[model samples]
Target chain A: MDTAAQPDTAPAENLSAKVYADLKMKLIVGQLRPAETLSIRTLAEEYGVSAMPVREALRQLASEDSLIGAAKKAYRVPDLTPSEAANLFFIRAILEGAAAEIAAENVRAKDIKFLEKLVQDMDTAWQNQDAVQFLLVNFKFHSRIYSLTGNSALQSMIESLYARTGPWLAHGITELVTIDSWMGDHPAIIGALRNRDAALARKLVEEDARWGVDLYRARS
Target chain B: MDTAAQPDTAPAENLSAKVYADLKMKLIVGQLRPAETLSIRTLAEEYGVSAMPVREALRQLASEDSLIGAAKKAYRVPDLTPSEAANLFFIRAILEGAAAEIAAENVRAKDIKFLEKLVQDMDTAWQNQDAVQFLLVNFKFHSRIYSLTGNSALQSMIESLYARTGPWLAHGITELVTIDSWMGDHPAIIGALRNRDAALARKLVEEDARWGVDLYRARS
Candidate 1:
């Protein structure tokens, strides 16, 4: 399990928000392992907070399906069956594809340049064998494109879908290094975005999402 | 604003779950109004529970985007702007369309019969001018089709999307009576499902979801 860093003291009312954000970030970064039991006391002790905030945070994550409430006072990160993982990836494909098509209609030169930089950064992360940086850049890359559509609801839904798959991706970061073909598709997606080709961009984005499923299946 | 019915006494350990479930149902049934402020103390009193469970339940709903936290210790049902609601509906079209496509592949004869019965019930509700029953059957009809896909994650995602629109639907029930064109699309969806045509099912489901947006737009 990846340990959480202690956060600075926040005002009393904001403690739960602070804890929830920190815990969600940890889950997104793959710092937490799936099926790992999360004890309120343990999390509180680690974060130097009291149990109340931790309890609230756990409930919030549980609502998002980021954590499963196994029993009274027991919460654990959910372990995705291969099929669940595939289903999520399929949904992401549909959503991200739609997002890309919308974004293409709105993409400006600056947006294309920003995406180009992200793809460049991802290549650098890949060359350095920095899985964490690669994952962060990769997430931002897609997120940036999704944001171009200016649809908060769609973007948030996509983020939530990413959160569902984040732990599994974190657990299998090493597998990403070996899956050279997986990252190979991003350049074409970038090209489609650069060319403002809505159809091609949508198709490539969907293909990229499927590649993510392929990576997960290979690792599992 | 629609007032919530008082819940029966729940064990201390399950109070939060009970409150969450009750609140969600109210939203689903349109008992809660959009942009209605939710006070913890008031809800605690109404449910005959403590502030703790109410607080937790509100946080859970906030995470689901069912309620928006506006300030410290204050939450409200989100009032969708026209575009925001349109975006959600578009995403629903994509998601429910994919669900229908998958369901078409896995649908059994009995599932077809069950869906046909739901369509029949919806017609009866419409004829009786019972908007509440129409809404309930409408929800169940789509829900039943989505479930045939046997994808829990997809089903849950679809349900959450429904939650986002439920309060608005509830608030606009009377408007449904004025919109005869809205329910006219269901029979075609049922026909596509009966034929077990994945592509047609997907297209009709997407069109059906758009009809929901049309209804909302008309009411707004």
Candidate 2:
């Protein structure tokens, strides 16, 4: 809530762009709560800019469905509904599964190493009880695989889905932390990628997404 | 290009909503050309509204990726690119296939009949060389199946993808008309739904999406 902007070093014209990017990141990282009402004046004051940029940023986010437009010049993060979460899980399964399948065929040894290192980082975060770091690293892990498809459009679509789900995931990080066997299939997924078993990789990725949904449901 | 608004019969506050919905429909039906520039002032003048609503509509469309943001207040439909189109096709195949698979399990007898009637209508359009009607019917046919899944989120996501690809599909309708077998797998898809064969339905839907991509590539 105290996400005050540091001094605005960005150019005048890019002020709105900077505000948009910052707010988008906040939504994606789950720093903002669901159903949280956001006032342009408040965000503008917090971000050390005038209300104009904040207004534009809110409009953009509302357009993306990351934020819901309320009354005039007011916006709120969409409240998470169980059905909406389930639908997003179904979609993530399809998209991430497709990405994993394509990446399996195209994955390089270096990519494997990169993902392995991320898993290691996530493990460390888990052990240290750093849910935030764990969540961030977990995102990077999947994003890397999706990026291997060499399709920016696909990556963007997948990322947008993540943005929609991230707030919920963040809210449920406590439950995620309690699950001892979190990311259970990640190693197998990596194995499939290493072996170039596209089908197995896809299946594992889909299952992994479904498992997240299960976790969310249980916690909710 | 002369998509002027008839009159503002809708309530005053809902003018922006109306503009957004109208522009969205135009995008989905492929009435707008890819890469065509859209000016807020011109649109406002045409729609018989202030520039505010038109600007908002453009922002919403750009957020959905159906249109590309150019300058501060300018927008354009995203130009068709082979790779972007191919990526969309792959994603659509995965999504539509999943929708079909789920719908196969949940589809009612009435849903099957509805789809059958649509296919018959499309056949007539095809026979009459009414490319526009054929394209519209083709969309409704697939949309009907996706709706049977009973997942509004999935339907919305699928619809957004259609919005992105619709202009390209519209541009390629002539070539689609020339093709002897435009919807080769639709009957099989309907048959799978009738029989509740989820796997076959999924496969057919995916193949149908891929075929559309092939047609687009050929035509473009």
Candidate 3:
């Protein structure tokens, strides 16, 4: 008997979707290595589910360009050549830079306070070397900033890009924990926004982003 | 037979997606009236498809936000409330205006000639009052300009926003077709860019977009 055909024995219908989401998260968080081949059947077996959901999940991930799929074939984590990685970085810089600028004029006092709390939380997570907590808080921090514009479309665009870049968030936070001055930039960014200094806030955010690229280059 | 189980085979899906795409094209070209609620099952049956596809198609349309899903889950053509419309206009002006400035330095001579040919095509489309053709060419015109940036991310961002504001595209183009002076702006924009005047090109593009919003409002 094919164990993969079993449906009600597990949440099989939704399992693929969940698996896809998990892998996508791991990819963005850098848990999964690039060019890693993830087998559908193996994943289904490991998760104690059927392959149908896994298939659908992979399809959606492929749509986001998180996974490479040969037509009518298997899937694997995409490996970017140096040039492709550079292109992605440049695009991220321009888009995120613009988003941060737009966000500066619209962020509220409460959001600033929330960000301050986020930094405090990150500090705790960093000291403890708690990767999961750091990642979650970082996601919240950026989402909150993106939400300031109240443009769902903008938020979705950012989310899609973040999804494609998978697993970079955790790596970013880990880097932050290592460099003492790194975390200082966030507060400065928030301060500029709080003061209604749009240009200054935008400059700070871009500078912060530039620093991250430099760090990534040094590390990677 | 309930016919609900095999919803995939039902014609609603076929009809609805077709209607959705058709209506979307019309809206994007300014042929369909805004504030319209295209009937659901009626359209499904009319198109010889089942309601499932229609329902899914409408939901998909909502995903791109070309159509708004409202109270009680009815899908309707989106109407740009004054403030929301203003916000959309300004965002486009800021983003696309910036894009033109960026593209000016990089735009090739061959691309400018292609743009001139596009303008001539628009003249023919305008003469025929071919709203669809005009819209198609208009899309090509702006897209060709957008392509000059060689930034997929930025192009994608602008396209996403453009899709969301599909209704405005149709309305804006239709009105521009009536006023001959509207089409003249494109050449002047190309002229400014050819002169390598990034600032002039940027200003012209900004003015052109603002002029569109004004024309759209005048129609209302």
Q: Pick the candidate with the highest DockQ.
A: 1
Model 1 has an lDDT value of: 0.78
lDDT of 3 by residue, A1-220 (tens): 1222112113222354356556655665566566778787887777677876566566556644667777546688777654445545555555456667778889887889999999998789767887756555655676687678766655655665565554444455565535666688888878877887877766776675465456567666
**What residue pairs are clashing in model 1?**
none
Any runs in candidate 3 off by more than 4 Å, and if so which? A1-33, A36-61, A64-70, A81-102, A130-132, A168-181, B1-62, B67-77, B172-181
Ranking by lDDT: 1, 2, 3
Q: Residue B129 in candidate 1 has what lDDT?
A: 75
> Which runs of model 1 end up more than 4 angstroms from their true locations?
A1-13, A175-177, B1-13
Best by TM-score: 1
Model 1 TM-score on a 0 to 1 scale: 0.90
Order of the predicted models by TM-score, top scorer first: 1, 2, 3
Q: Residues B1-220, candidate 3, lDDT per residue (tens digit)? A: 1121112222222344355555445555555557777666876776677875566556545545667775456677778776566656665676677778888999899989998998999889889987667766766677788778776656655664555565666666655545776787889988987888999888888787676567667777
In candidate 2 the C-alpha lDDT for residue A152 amounts to 70
For candidate 1, write residues B1-220 as lDDT tens digits.
Answer: 2333323223325888888877876676566788999999999998787899999998888877889975575799988776777777888899899999988888888877888888888888878876656666787888888998887777777777777887777666665557667666777887787788999999989998887677777765
RMSD of each: 3.6, 3.8, 7.7
- DockQ, each predicted model: 0.63, 0.52, 0.15
TM-score of each: 0.90, 0.87, 0.73
